[model samples]
Target: MTHITVDLPETVFSALRKTPDEFAQEMRVAAAIKWYELGQISQSKAAEIAGLSRAEFINALFRYQVSPCQYTEAELARELSDAD
Candidate 1:
């Protein structure tokens, strides 16, 4: 894997340093979940951003109570009609 370096404020780095890698991983997962919740990104893209497999990301969604599937009102109505 390739490594990339990013510069953050010293205080930010210091705060991040307090947590172990596992904590960082969980934070990434949570951020991905929030992004999905906000309709800011697709589930596949969120999984990639979180450095997790699609299955793992779906699991995180379950853990965070974020639905993997989202639909507009029109789409929901269409689905309901199709069910009849």
Candidate 2:
């Protein structure tokens, strides 16, 4: 796996009241949420990226106000039609 380093102002930690590890974890969760919401990645992939279990990721989505569903209106209609 490839690792990337990010440089932050020293005051950022103090300002955010987060330790380096805590901040890094938050960044991972935020990235996962954004990618998942944008439909760039599947929920399982996002969960992996966020270092969370699938259930945990679903909870995170609720906390972050991101819907778990990614279906479009037409897709929903088709699904409903198929169900009937």
The top-ranked prediction according to lDDT is 2
Off by over 4 Å in 1: 1-19, 79-84
lDDT of 2 at 4: 83
Q: What TM-score does each of the candidates earn? A: 0.67, 0.91
lDDT of 1 by residue, 1-84 (tens): 555454545565466665455656776798888998898999999998789999999998999887888787899999999999
Error (Å) of candidate 1 at residue 58 is 0.5
Each prediction's RMSD to truth? 3.6, 1.1
lDDT of each: 0.82, 0.95
Clashes of each: 0, 0
Cα deviation of 1, candidate 1, in Å: 8.8
